[model samples]
Target: MDHNHQDPSTGLLTKEFAEGLGQFMAFASNQETTLQMGKMYCPCPICQNRRFGTVRGVWKHLYSRGFMAGYKVWYSHGETDLMVNFGSISQQNNLDEVGEQQGGVDEHIGNVQMVEDRFRVEEPKFEAQIFFDMLDAAKTPLYDGCRDGISPMSSATRMMSIKTDYNLSEDCVDAIADFVKDILPEDNLSPATYYEIHVSGLGLPYQMIDVCIDNCMIYWRRDVVRTSCRFCGKPRFQETRGKSKIPYKIMWYLPITDRLKRLYQSKHTAEAMRWHGEHESNREISHPSDAKAWKHFQSMYPSFAFERRNVYLGLSSDGFNLFGRHRRQYSLWPVIVTPYNLPPSLCMKREFLFLTILVPGPEHPKRSLDVFLQPLIYELKMLWDYGVEVYDIASKENFMMRAVLMWTINDFPAYGMLSG
Candidate 1:
């Protein structure tokens, strides 16, 4: 008969269909919270120090605190398994610490430095595979449709691919090495300027984001020459032009105006006033007129709104060109930056971290590396807010990885300092 018919309001269906639909809705609504409950038992030192007697207790505590409350839960078997592995490692480390403290003879005073050193010796390396697993677990099933051994695209991979394609060269393998040599800060090749590179172009842009330069060496050198984009397939070398020379700098200013507009639009005038009051009372303001000046700026720039978007930097040996315009492959460097010092309310909080990489372009009478690197200034500001201590740059090329590791550890003074 005519089974497709349905009521307008309820959209009437057969009893079986209605029941099935109800089941689906319930599953969808509770999915995230349910999955969060399953994998909330993290064994990190931060969680372990909470005096939870067991792993299960930690999980329960996280749930009670609503750590993942209202967050959409995405499940990945690999991620859950990885979390378990990390938790086990953390637990073992904790046990080791207890053993060290208890076994010491001679009524010993607890050496804080020794304890700190032991912890660093035990800390797990941040593996890309683990990160990929985390991202997978965080993504929903509907979006995780790839086959076995394949996971979803990441922000890192996508940016790298875009950058690679924009600067495609048959000699990219060789070019990157030369590029690294040219950007070396001084000739010391210290760890401060280490970097890495990756190339991919087969997937969706955003999903392909991944770090190419994990760690590489940087050395001191002043005479290195930048190369033009050979991917453009033209004999003429072209340099990056205009505001494009520093895309990051132009985008940085946009967020400031954008934040002010949002504050005005949300009618957070009283909160704004309170912030000013707090600023004055706390002496957070550099000058007495700073508060008034801020309010005035907000009032005048009511339409100011910063659109947070990804900024990709691609250099063509030929010149910068959009992806579809060229037939030949070019090497592209996708530089991603977040607007600096965004209001706390607009930040990702726990996961917000910023990184910047500098790639020198071929020197030409027309373009300057000074202009090229200017955009990164704003990115540096954002990184500061996130307490980023380490920078992985590849310019002068030695000890890049070690420097990054040191920075990651020492930069957050609250966590303790990194030693050479």
Candidate 2:
């Protein structure tokens, strides 16, 4: 946040702070709850809200000492918005990002939780934490004075891109961040190091379910117990966070349910997702709607076709060597799913092609591939039967959105494996 910034023209407090000060005084005017009955906690640098002052006294302290650095979030006041975790929340963790001479540690769970604790009324589950992170990151500006519409999440993504494109080291990234931060205005928004920028949340969410090392079976559903593989009797174990060994290797399952919901949430693609239903494609076979299978499925299940927003999806899988041709002898199988509801061009676009599952392999699973597909299949069933609550952007209404897997896109070997 922009702390201690002065308006160049007036040589006084920034427009934001000056404006906020008025609101703070107004709120304190009527509210009886404060550091004292007739006084509020002084948020100025001299008092740091630990000292109480009358409205006039508080104003004088702020005018002389300036508001405490990074006091954008009014947590002491009655505001409990998600962004209130900023500035003071790190008091429970490290505060080097606020320009402490001792330097800063890399961003970690402790630091995150310390900030997050300020906003939580009760203990949040894993999903709730993720939701808050995603929400806050999206709402937060890239920096205090950012006007480009970029956010911290987008900034982290761009940093990742540059790091990969140039193969920069962590130290090099730190140096670059330091240089950029030095040149930029003095604000808490620009992190000093790449480590400090720690990007996380729903940006990359994938389930790591236990799987049989031999790909014989996945340790899911009723088999969540059992110390060994059901089919081959091979031991499946991995160390948990508590250092306890648990059965099963791993298979990455990226759920498509949330991705589908986001399609309707975004204004950019919400309209495009239903383009096939709204626009006339004629009989020219430009999209999947012009194909026989799409029409056949619609005719057979008119109830499913009744909702124009209901998604039709295509599932595809392929196997490829993980280590190019000759370095390491290992393969990887990736299962991708795409919606057929989009126009032909967008349907094939990389952004829309969702990779739902990754079946690990020194070799392909072959007939055992179904073992890794259990989660995807379960989610698909849920989408078809129960559906999910979604907010449509174009219609500006909530609806129960359903999805159906129309067909599979795969080579002959994959097709055969799936059938088996």
Candidate 3:
């Protein structure tokens, strides 16, 4: 089937998009929603009475109803109504008191007012309204002015330049904050905190945890909050100026599932994510999804291909001197995870690279990596077995997303430690 077709005007379906959609539909059929029908079924409201056997069907369903314009209307109004109702309720209480003072509070009048108030207050009780609203508003025009792309000058624009051009330090951020105090009050966010808030605004935030100095384990849940390392029995915090303390190493855990869902929430990224499944077929050396091994794997393990959105990840870790080997002996090991479902061209982009764990080191984790990898491994396994419930912005429905750690990427020098 010639699934790839690009509109001259909108340029919606390129080879990449077609390939991604085809691939997604292939696996989406295995999901519970579609599996029973033995054909791809779109849950979009427009497709309520229709069934399609191709990726084009899925694409059309999402394009037409996925953005949820109706849902957004209801959402914005509902929020406005709630705020209005709050003020109204307060006003009504005062009026009720006034009526009682004036001896105008007949029992029937009181009962009528009470009933009217209940109806007004309970009018916003359309549950699931917010969820649908969020889905509708997520990638809307509101994001364009704030974070879409680099503009000539804006708070976001300046922050981008400061981080890329200048030293990424607390003082640098503070200075920028001072510079833009009138225009945009940063409220003295350290660079780290600023980045955290920035990403969180996009619906992705990272969790930071202290790790064992020996790289033997991470100081995580069920392990004394800030006591000695459970495995090595070494103090979790190091002595500093007087009573001040600092962690020896830190581990950052980034939730993979939510971020993956965010990909679908945004129009551009969501389309780009389907690149792998949307690319032209019957071609050699096009993309990773076109590889023989990928097809063979799909054929061999059909279960893994059940969810088109299920991410296949590649993990990589290596240690490098913090300040060139000669200047300082200190080293840092950053563990990065990448989503391979995106087109190969985009799969390795810095934006798609996720920093899951940061292992501070004077030496490599070697042999101790297993201990530090506990959290990631546990999450991956749970994702594969149980999966996570994620909303589909296009289909206007929720589905389970399962992910797999397809492989690891590391240099020859660090291969032995990270491999097994």
Question: Candidate 2 overall Cα lDDT vs. reference?
Answer: 0.69
Relative to the true structure, candidate 2 reaches a TM of 0.60
lDDT head-to-head 1 vs 3, winner: 3
Misplaced by over 4 Å in model 1 are 1-283, 286-293, 305-337, 340-420
lDDT per residue as tens, model 3, 1-420: 223244558645455644433433333433443445344544344443222333343444443333222322121111235544453233333444433433431223344543443232111112234444544544343223455532222344356566768667756665654555444323322223345324424344577778877876777777737578666689888888877768887866776766776666555675565566546767786766788877777667665564566677888988888888486687678888888888877888898898877766777666777666777888888998988766554544455678877778888877877645
370: Cα error in model 2, Å: 0.7
Q: What CA RMSD would you report for each candidate?
A: 26.1, 21.2, 18.6
Off by over 4 Å in 3: 1-179, 182-203, 224-226, 240-245, 278-280
What is the lDDT of every predicted structure here? 0.28, 0.69, 0.57
In Å, residue 394's CA in model 3 sits off its true spot by 3.6
Candidate 1 displacement at residue 97 in angstroms: 76
Candidate number achieving the greatest lDDT relative to the actual structure? 2
Local accuracy of candidate 2 as per-residue lDDT tens digits, 1-420: 236545668556676765555555554434435423455666766446544455555655554445788776665554446634542343323223222321221122243553343232323345434554587667787667788667766666677678889999999988987887788666635556777665533455677888888888887779888788878888888657877786545788999987888787666888788776656766688888877888898778765664668999989998998889788877799999999888877889999999999888787687988878889989999999989877665554456689999889888988998963
Worst 10 residues of 3 by lDDT: 70-79
